[model samples]
Structure formats: structure tokens, C-alpha cells
Target: MMIKELEKLFVRDLEKLRGELDQYPNEETLWKVVDGISNSGGNLVMHLCGNLQHFIGAVLHDTGYVRQRDFEFNGRMDLNQLNEEIGKTIEVIRSYFKDADSETFDGDYPLEVFGYPMSIGYFLIHLQGHLNYHLGQINYHRRILS
Candidate 1:
């Protein structure tokens, strides 16, 4: 039940992330850096995608995803590629979650991501929060730059 809810929110926000990227005027502006804003909307989408792919997709389910953390922030993708990546991220989440049971949430997470063990359920919620935080940043970035 918990995993289902989390998965829904994750997919919803990821779709929104894709929409945000598509809404950008162009690929260049998606990666634009102004005086006040450091990270562009494109970079934020990439970061969120990688973050989820690594944590939920790879870590929890062993999807064999290799996450390049730095490139997530530095990399540039055109709107089409960005949309595809986010779509892939969404499928990754849904793939594991479709078979996930309540027990999947109660166990300890495979990694001590913050230097201490945390429950899978707790860590999942944390990941969701992280996703939304960046999603908001991307939305604000789009507004400010536009």
C-alpha cells in the first residue's frame, strides 16, 4: 500500500518534470545559467532522474542502472531526449513497484545511504521528498528564467 502510493507520486512528479522540460522555450534555455540561478531546469530534471534511478530503480530493485551523479547536473539533453529519460525513469519505478508487496517496505534498505541503516519505507519517502524538492526548483527555474 505504501509503496503503491509512493510509486504514484513518483510517477506523477516525474511526468510533471517531463512536462516542465517540454515547456521550456528551447534546449539552450533549459540549460541556461543566469546571475542568480546556478542550476538550469534541464539539469534539475537530469538530477532528479538520476537520483531516482540510482536510489529506487537500481538500489532497491537492482535494475542495473549506472548513475553518473556529476553528469546528471552537468549533462545537456534536448527536449526529446530529456522526455525519454524521464519516461524511462518512470517505467523503472513502476516496474519494480508493480510486484512490490507490503513486506518490501518494512525491511532495511540495502544501503546505509546516509552512513546509517534506514528502513526501506522511510528511505523511499525520503527519496520522494528529494524528488519534489528538485521538481519545485525546476519549476521556479523555468518561471524565473522565462
Candidate 2:
């Protein structure tokens, strides 16, 4: 089914992000920001992870999720912890999708997130794209920091 495919893609992309992030020798370097507009490589990791939580809470549950948008912006985390967080986020997403049906992905399941209407399929695609974009940033940061 489409949900199964999306779940596979999601896991694949997460693995790719993890592999790319693992290339950074020094974890602290992942926290170095190049410009004011861009976040550090590590920040991107946290950003994506936090967004996962938001999506799972908002789209999946409709409520009961508290997102610390500010906390994700503050401080540096150990690479191990960062990886653990990322893994946790991925697990949450996977679990969410496992129970999803075609109707859920086909717009039959409608939800208002941040006051915007979203389809589960659209949200999943958006999350995958978002992760890929940040993965690119992390890769670039690694190259520049090296």
C-alpha cells in the first residue's frame, strides 16, 4: 500500500541522514553555524527531530504533544544523544505510519494542524522533503567545517 511505501521511504531517508551525519568527525563541529540565517549542522538534526515530534503529535494524535520550539534552538548536544533523539523520532514516525490506512493517506483523514488543513499523505511527503533539505545542509556543513 501507499502507506507502506511511504514508511519505507521515510526510514530510508532517516538512514541516509544518519549516515551523512556520521561522517562528521567532531560532533561539536556539527553545531557551528555559518551564517545568521542558517542553523548549525547539529541544529538541523534537532530541528528535524523536533519537527517529527510536532507532526506525530499534531497530525497523528490531534493533541497531547508539547513541542519545545525554543529548546531545540538552544545549546549543543553530544553526538550520541543527538543520534538517540533522531532514532526516537524515527521510531515514533514509523509507529504512527504503521497504523495508517489508505484512507488516511488519501485525504479521507483530515486534520487541522497549526490552523492549516493537511492530508496525511501530504504531511508525510513534506516531512520527507524537509528531512532531505536539512540533510543537504548537514552535508554542506560537514564539508565546510572540515
Candidate 3:
């Protein structure tokens, strides 16, 4: 039940991320570095995609996703490309958890992501919250640019 609820939240937040990507006036705008903020919105999008795809898709579902964590923060993607990655992320999250059972949620996450192992459910919840936090930053960046 927790995974299902988290699934809904993940999808909801990702949809909101898509909207944020849509709101950007241009690709260059999404990558602009504000005076104080070093992170570009485009970079954040890539980071989110790489992070979720690797953690949830690869780790949990054996989806064979390989994350390039540095590229996520350093690379740039056009709006359409970001949307594509987001779409893939959404699909990965949806299908992985669609048939998840208690064992899936209760099981220990394979990696020691935060210095120690945690339940899959706890990791998923952490990831969902992370998404929302970045989503807000993207929204704020868009507003600042506008």
C-alpha cells in the first residue's frame, strides 16, 4: 500500500516537473546560472532523471540503468530531451512498482545509499521528497527568469 501511494506521489510530482519544463521560455533559459544559485534548471532535471532511474529502476527492478551522476549535474539537455527523460523515468517508476508486493517494500534496499541500508519503502519515500524539493527549485528558477 505504501509503494502504491508513493507511486501516485512520484507520478504526480514528475508530471509537475514536466509542467515546469514546459513553462521555461527557452532551453537556454533553463540552463542559465542565476547570480547566487549555481544549479541550472536543466541540470536539475537531468540529475533527477539519472538519480531516480538508477536508484528505483536499476536497483529495485534490475532495469539495468546505469547512472552518470556527474553528467547529471554537468550536462545540458534541450526541453524536448528533458521531457523524454522524464517520460522514461515515469514509465520506469510506474512499471517497477505496479506489481510490487509486501516483499518489495519490506525488503532491504540493495545499496547503502546513505551510509547504511534501508527499506525499499523508506528509500522510495526519501526519493519522492527529494523530487518535490527540486521541483520547487525549478519552479522558483522559472519565476525568477520570467
Give the TM-scores of the predictions, in the order they appear. Answer: 0.94, 0.85, 0.96
TM-score for candidate 3, please give it: 0.96
Q: Which model scores highest in lDDT?
A: 3
lDDT of 1: 0.86
Selected candidate, larger TM-score, 1 vs 2: 1
Candidate 3, residues 7-125, lDDT tens digits: the string is 89999999999999889898889999889887999999999999899999998888999999988998877778899999999999999988798787888999998999899888888
Of the two candidates 2 and 3, the one with more favorable TM-score, higher being better, is 3
Clash count of each predicted structure: 0, 0, 0
> Stretches of candidate 3 above 4 Å error?
none
| lDDT of every model, 2 decimals | 0.86, 0.76, 0.90
lDDT of each residue in 29-138, candidate 1, tens digit only: 88888888888888888888888889988888889999998998887777887888898899999997997888888899999999999888889889889988988888
Provide the lowest-lDDT 10-residue window in model 1: 18-27
Model 2 CA deviation exceeding 4 Å by range: 61-65, 108-115
Candidate 2, residues 19-95: lDDT per residue as tens digits? 87788877777788776446888778878888877876555755455777777778668888888877877788777
In what order do the candidates fall by lDDT, top score first?
A: 3, 1, 2
